[model samples]
Target chain A: MKLTRYNPSTLTDFDSWFRQPFVGFPSAAQVFSDSGSNRLAADIQEDKDNYFAQFEVPGVKKEDLKVELNNQILTISAEKKQTAGDTEQTYSLSRAISVPDGVQGDAISAKLENGILTVTLPKAEHRKPKTIEIA
Target chain B: MTTNCCNPSPTQQTAEPEAAVMKPRYFVDGTQEAYEVRVELPGVPKEGVSINLEENVLTLRAKRTPSALSDWKTLHRELKGLDFLLRLRLNTQVDEEKMTAALDHGILTLKLPVKEAAKPRRIEVQ
Candidate 1:
């Protein structure tokens, strides 16, 4: 069976419809698409409370990294500089993720511990349930 | 005719298993004292990391330990549960004896000291 690579930026229903011919599982497709955005491989997971995204960023010091959020869009960018054989080489990777409507962008917090950068965006409000009384 | 027998193409090394997703991105920064090698290995803990240098070749391998939380379903799992492997051919200037490595935050940083002969030397003339 062929595996389809997943791109997280896809939120439209038509995107899933187009992917119907390729991968049967969504999680497997997401794993296969790690090669799309340069050397940055990140995972987004959901639980009862919040959504967490952990990105792989090695050799990037804290000062060279930047995280910005605007209107539910989170952008992670980092600049990697190295001096190889007396010649300076630089490379930068940036990824912008579109958060769902329920996420609280203002309450988002990020921390860099051990080389992985973890960004947590809490769910703003839970869906309210409605009930109709039977007479 | 020039013979390029010293460098071996990465594909020639067949000891790696088929399951491995080889050739991870790496950065080599050369300084006056030593060369720093950085490899991104997310989700790997400190215990399973290994770095070995032998016969002019440097090999890096890390095995992923299954987390005890099997009851949870994996959604959008990317970096976890995948083993890491990369075999890099090193130059002769690398001082194998003094090499050091550490794993933090899923990134492995290795310091390879340059041999004395390979370092730049200043000569005085009368």
Candidate 2:
């Protein structure tokens, strides 16, 4: 199945549609205006087994990146000090993702290249069915 | 690109220092199958959002309905200003009819499915 892009501003059926409730009214300033250089983009890849998350977090040091796991949920957060862009201003961006059940937490790993941060979460073994004799 | 239909034009609102103003951020990504565009517009409710396609241009505009609820004693104003704009141009191969948008969690995602003629296909043996 293909997932369509979500545009909140252009939604015509918001009143008639039922959702899980928004995590506060997210605004452009809340996400983009924070202390430190912000995460410019994120790429989430999910297959039959596991999910991989990659983020473009430039000008951030390796130690600044933080990852937390709680009850099958994973939240990746980071903070970068202000650079040339806004020396007088500070900004931060945080994203939390819920991991599916039966996945190993310690096996997750992250790597930074240039300014991109990539995290790979391996899926737990999937169960397959087998037939048994009726005798 | 400014069409003066609304009471307070967003572009002008962003220029003023009355309240908190926002800046538009564009996300452009390419995968093996297609390219995705994610533009972030926060604070504005879904009712005030509009996306239009004319010629090769794709325009996005979202604003906030200035609220009347104000607490004089408890208010610490951080500039909750309105007016946001996101605009783009599509290539000739993009399928305009299949374009989709959803406002989830606060992120505006636009999924422009590629035309069948533009996708890569493999020929099988007869």
Candidate 3:
């Protein structure tokens, strides 16, 4: 009897291939929602003075984008509408990130440019790092 | 020398580089007259995007603007510093000369008009 080699990598390859629909050709909705999660991907970075959060939100108008900060939680919500032929489609996506300490909530500012929403949270005056000189 | 049956060899594993080029997410829709393709290319300026059509295949490439905040500490990251490359094969004939493209809010929209001869026409009943 001939024996077959059990390769574990093949299982992972098959799993990823099955997750993406149509294999080589992906439709618009499939790529937009990301396997039906409907959650927007984001990146957060911090410097000595400020914390920056960037969100990828394509095909969304500025008026439809909303950013809210409450109780140390930053929430980003957006709505995208598309009309093709006789059908109309609307997709809503929202994601929240907990803010760290020492953030100036009232001074937070958000800007939408080139399909990216950057929310900048400045650190409070006392929260900034102080460079003490040697006496 | 001895080896486990389930453990794969170290040389067989290939690790993809973190900065490798990636295909940006896109959506395509079409009506009878034209097809609309929208590509999400965040952090890429209008001048960094290029579209080319050769034969029946359409190619789109976008280079993202490099981040200047390299000294900042990353708290969480989902975006990568990689360019976008996408190639699509068109089964239907398209009017290449009449095609139009627009970039707004980091999203690129391409409108490919269908060839007049290839458009579906309803035959009149006698």
> lDDT per residue, candidate 2, B1-126, as tens digits?
111111222333335444444445656554434456655554445676788866656667777543322321211122334466655655535577887887642356676666789666799999
Stretches off by above 4 angstroms in model 3 are A1-36, B1-19, B121-126
DockQ each: 0.29, 0.02, 0.33
A118 Cα displacement, candidate 1 (Å) = 1.9
Clashing pairs in 3: A114-B105, A114-B106, A115-B105
Interface RMSD values for the candidates, listed in order? 4.1, 17.2, 6.2
Report residue A51 deviation for candidate 3 (angstroms): 0.5
- Candidate 3 — what's its lDDT? 0.72
**Model 2 chain B: ten consecutive residues of lowest lDDT:** B1-10
Q: Candidate 1 falls in which docking quality class? A: acceptable
Score candidate 2 by TM-score against the native: 0.38
Model 1 steric clash total: 2
When summed lDDT is taken over every stretch of 10 residues in candidate 3 chain A, the lowest stretch is: A13-22
lDDT tens digits, residue span A7-117, model 2:
677553321121211133344235443342543334455444445665645445678778777655555677755422124344565655445555668888887644456
Best by lDDT: 3
Q: How good is the docking of model 3, by CAPRI class? A: acceptable
For candidate 1, write residues A93-135 as lDDT tens digits.
7665656667777889987755667788787666222366999
Q: What ranking of all candidate models by TM-score puts the best one first?
A: 3, 1, 2
